[model samples]
Target: MQRFPFRFAPAYRLPALLFGVTPGTARVEVDDTELRARFGPWSLRTPLTNVASVERTGGFQFLKTAGPAHLSFADHGVTFATNGDDAVCVCFHEPVRVLDPTGRLRHPGATFTVADPPALLAALEDLEER
Candidate 1:
């Protein structure tokens, strides 16, 4: 299994603690069959095959992606962020439900502020080649 911890900015750490999101609690883990994430109380799980693509991105507005999971109003993408710096956006073949409780609202992509963006991206890419 490949695991990546979330990057916690010094300024954001205190706020994250309130949501029960610490470095130990927020992480993304990938095994042969599944990709699982735990960000405080929110979690996202999907089959490895469901992953379509991954890209590195940044420049986040604090209000939009500071603490818990945030859903994009424009794209319906969910962001599991701890910091505003580096993040990897993973697009899925099929949209997954998150942010909404009814299970009707699904997101086509998810962005994670993992500690190592390149490593996480490379890991997913290597899985694709296998």
Candidate 2:
């Protein structure tokens, strides 16, 4: 499968670093069967088949954080995001594991910032058609 790649928008760096996130090192790659995201030391991959939903979002708003960029974890759902604004949230059919910057495993779904979200979505849709 060919790798469809996209960089994250530039605006997320400072906020991400402020919350202890690696910041400014975000990228995504979509292949025929899975979607992968990387931000500094953190990485996540989910089989396309396991994805239950995907949505474009304005990202976290008014949500105070002890650490806005902390690794995300959820037993039933996971959301991996780079910045607190402008993100793509993915939900999976079953609990999935993700690797954080510390290489620890966490479950559920993941989110990431994309430079061109619509293009990513279009790529996913194309993959679904295959």
Top candidate, metric lDDT: 1
What TM-score, computed on C-alpha atoms, does each candidate reach? 0.95, 0.63
lDDT to native, each model: 0.90, 0.56
Off by over 4 Å in 2: 1-11, 15-24, 62-82, 99-106
**Ten-residue segment with the worst summed lDDT in candidate 2?**
61-70
lDDT of residue 62 for candidate 2: 30
Candidate 2 structure quality by residue, lDDT tens digits, 10-109: 4544555664455344567777678777655556677888777677765464332122434443343344454456656676776555544343555565
lDDT per residue, candidate 1, 1-130, as tens digits?
9999998988778878888889888999999999899889888999999999999998887877877788998999999988898899999999987777788999999999999999999989887888
Query: Global CA lDDT of candidate 1, please?
Result: 0.90
Q: Count of backbone clashes for each model?
A: 0, 3
